[model samples]
Target: MSENTINAVTRRHWVLIACMLSMFMAAIEVTIVATAMPTIITELGGFSQFGWVFSIYLLTQAVTVPIYGRLADMWGRKRVFFIGAGLFLLGSILCGFASSMGWLILFRAFQGLGAGAIMPLTSTIIADVYPPKERAGVQGWLSSVWGVAAIVGPLTGAWLVQHFNWALVFWVNVPIGIISMLLLVRFFPESREKTDRRINFTGSCWLMLTVTALLTALLQAESLGYWTLVLSAVALLAGWGLLRHERYSGEPLFPLAIWRTRTLLAGNVGNLLIGAAMMGISAFLPTWIQGVSGGTPLQAGSALAMMSIGWPLASTLSGRLMQHTSYRFTAQLGSLLLIAGTAMLLILHRESPVWYAGLSAFVIGTGMGMTSTTFLIAVQNTAQFEIRGICTASVMFSRMLGSALGTALMGAVLNYNLMLRLPQYSDPVQQVMSPAGREQLKPANLDLMLTEIAHSLHWVFVVSLIIAFGSLLMSRLVPVQKPH
Candidate 1:
């Protein structure tokens, strides 16, 4: 290779680093708020609308990911990425100044729209720059950022909220975003592939509607009984129509050919389920700690820090193992770990030792590290070079969808179980809950509620276990030979 070739490759590597850093900012922000949410909601005075703050962000992100991914392919990754980063920064600023819970939720949706673009495009850009054999190692580095961020995000968020204010959590993104944008503008090469293709506006609308309806049904399943059925039917119809449109359209959002491959379909389904489990645990576990363990915000945050420890370690280790073993075996081991970790949670109680809770979290994080990185590699290996971007984006889309559904569904489940079990308590118990409504329930009542919450959470883990087992089953479908 010439000197210019070497220089180009080196620059590309640095670009990947910069992109990954920006992605880490986004990922961390999502979880950092978890520990700080109690403080945020209390200050903002809207505990009733608390779930929407998270849900709308996820819903918008889920709806926009594929659209952004497709646009990146058509327009260019770097340009679309900058647009996303800018929007995310703007949303962050607005969120920092949000006066009410409703405003915060709405701003969060804006943040999600921007965040949706960053994740898929980050991976797509990596795929564009690296070959199959080297991609796993690069992905391992990216995955490590997620693990590191998870640990840092909550702890940092707690400290900020404790000493400063909840607004600092959103404001922190400002400098990170600015630095990432500057790096990309200076160091990253600007590349675009010009295509005469037009946007599939109709198909995009249908796809968005389908996703919205599906998520709405899942989120409201416990509340609006008849609306759930109506929304579900709408989702099914829209899904069917979208499929038909894509099959006939000359340029589809996602090519039907990708789904025809059994490996892609099975791997994506498993990814979706894993995403649900991961998000569910991440969102609720802190609440569980506060409820059951008599923990302060920082203490609850510390418990989740264990997951950050395990995830990156396993991700780096899995990258090395990929060089020696089949991706199938590595992914299977990860899936099994997920099942074991989640199953352990089924037996968890308020009296369970902190170390035990941490152990379960570590196991779950290890499983996430293994499965997430490996699945991305599998999708890249299965698809052709030209379509690699789309395939990779599709996997991410599945995970985002799963996460959205999981957060909403788990929130509803937790609420429902609390309601069901609350009636069993005596009048004194009811009086304890009356001050802050459910949020102000006494520690004893809180513990009682959390026991039921744990039961509800067990169902989540059981679903996750089934999903991980399913992923293990689908690992066989991945072709032994890597695609060219």
Candidate 2:
């Protein structure tokens, strides 16, 4: 292992570049799809099924994180990542040829499944390559990939759709993925000792079922009121079965005992609430801007873009912060910033300027970067090398779950208010998003609905503020970091 670690070809920077490119490909999937979906619908004409394309991808990705994380630990990060990247690239290629929205959604799900490995392993590999002091800074740069992807994704998609074919957008990741995989094969030579390969396949299946049902229920709460309840029941049963099995299984996939430690407990819980807060703001703040603040879509995007700015900037700085201060202090500071940022959001109104929204977004993003980075490093430091992959995956899994939870809960909040305030109208949120749709409504109706949207958005902010405070309190429970 030391021999490979010292090999000249696999310099830290090169591997970092590969990891960044790999993650950027995965991270950019949603935004690029957002840009290209119009063209896709025009050509393929599955406007009714459009949302499923994105949802299925994320659903598959989120469910597979724990699975891949466990595999990475058992086999090796390199091996698991190779399999995932191959699947993702294959999905990308197949998606290009998809003739219908159903086919595209299936292919995107494949891409998402691969992405589960790509995203979490980036950090796990970084932890393998870098020590504690350097880890935070390097991970900071890694965190910036999402920001870069967000900025770059739309432009790239638009250009592809304009000058080339919309189908080509799906193909773009192939070369990037190939290059990333090649770098790893060349640089990351892992001499992993074979371990017992009899994994708890049953537990894995049950876990997947549990997560899928729960996420589906949350995503469809407003739309599929009855089906959502059914899904929730299934999820609860699946979760119970998983727990029961894990207790008796010889090698549980979940590693439940580890969660008893304060370090992972506090860190994961904090990460979860932070995820909720971030999603609430990301999902709705733009709604406030476009529908309520009377801003253009471009202006609204720029407002949310402030988070992209704050995220990378704060992420890059968090390493140095950990170097000087304790992990607890750094994460605690981030938690405070989170509360402050969400509080700032409470002040936004129809009369509030776009920059004010941008400022709030920036503050929130800054807090997320700081808190997430510190906790990630701290968790990695605390975990045994053998379990490090799962530990890293746990951070991402918590965030992803938190995101799903937050989106559903806050969307419920927004929809409940809309239903009460605009009783005669159906799907006011949709009309709020579309200028043409807004024009179809009566002027008086439009004004009243817009006012209601702004009011409900404030309630969303209030929910986010509460979650942010929870994140802070959770951060307080993290144990002092011990160097591995």
Candidate 3:
């Protein structure tokens, strides 16, 4: 009730708001930009190069996350956050001015590097500021931002493109990022004397190289073909070198202690599998609705929207549930839901209703929401402040890697099945995406296309179900957290 206490409370709220805003900007950035890309590509006139704008951004973000995590812990969250947010906002400004696809790709890379810092630090800073009892509830608010962004971002992007210029999609981040940065600068202050500032340049380079090569191989596997093998080899070499260097370094960039913590490791494993399942559903569900079930794009999208609905609702409940129960129990419940959801997916076919697909998506998303929050809270609770940033970033990195792996794995299965049944078509999925496209084909070709796609996707669903079971195993392996 005292004035200083009231001032402190206000400052914390402002800081939380800033974190939320920063998170929203990052979360919405992909969806909004994607919605506007068709218009931007038409204007920029490099349809071939536009994919790099997204791939480069993802590669940079994933690679930098662990590096930024270590840096944040060593330098301080506020300092690192400012650097990241500044880079992101600057990238946004530059993207708005970009006249060509190449320039946009380069600017988006800058944005990705900044995003690498912002994502993990938001949770880390919230952990730093709030007490244990209050942290989960506040984290719930952060979780909801993702759902809100998912629901709002594309719609906003469509409106912006319809009425105004496509550049507004990039510019929109400017005001939001500026407000977030100013709020943090005012409310969240840091001191150089409080941080270690120990730079591990060699280890950092090795880490970055490893992540870059690995992700490059994963992302470019299809396009690069045999060349991906060389990248994969380089990634393995870099990874081995990194482990050796970190073993003897006085201050390791990636703390070795993390591997020794069973609960933390299990939590991250759960996150990884959850990420795989998430990618499977999000990537394929809409395609299933459109290609397999003969639904429109909007109908496909509406089915997918069920995920955003389930996610926010479950996230709001997860913190309270975790507060009242053990993390193991909550995570296990989520895993079971994942199993149920993925099982539901197995029953879907060309004749299945869209609402049924939507229901399945909702259940899967609810599972993801519950497990993700539980894993994050448990990881943070287990780690001390000196290592919290790295711990949090590890979670993010795990999920990213898992998602990439999932995309590759499911794509392989789908492609394998498609090729086995229908060998002549190089782009069967695309051929089946629209009714008009299918109508142009012979009846024999259309029947084969639909049948193979449905069969291939069934295997993809089977893989997701396996991943759900793996998550359950990880959940059971998670040692119950003693309350903080």
Candidate 1 clashing pairs, residues 3+ apart or interchain: none
Tens-digit per-residue lDDT, 288-352, candidate 3? 99898889988888888888778777877888888788788888888888899999999997899
- Model 2 poorest 10 in a row by lDDT: 1-10
Instruction: Quote the positional error of residue 434 for candidate 1 in Å.
Output: 11
How displaced is residue 414 in candidate 1, in Å? 7.1
Q: Which lDDT tens digits does candidate 1 get at residues 18-111?
A: 8777888888987888778999888889887887887788788888888887777677777888998889889999999999998999999999
**C-alpha-based local distance difference test score of model 1:** 0.76
Candidate 3 — what's its lDDT? 0.85
Give me the runs in candidate 3 sitting further than 4 Å from their true place: 1-10, 191-197
TM-score of each: 0.85, 0.95, 0.95
Q: What is the Å distance of residue 204 in model 2 from its true position? A: 0.1
Candidate 2: tens digits of C-alpha lDDT, residues 314-348: 88888888787778788888988888989998888
Candidate 1, residue 363: lDDT: 95
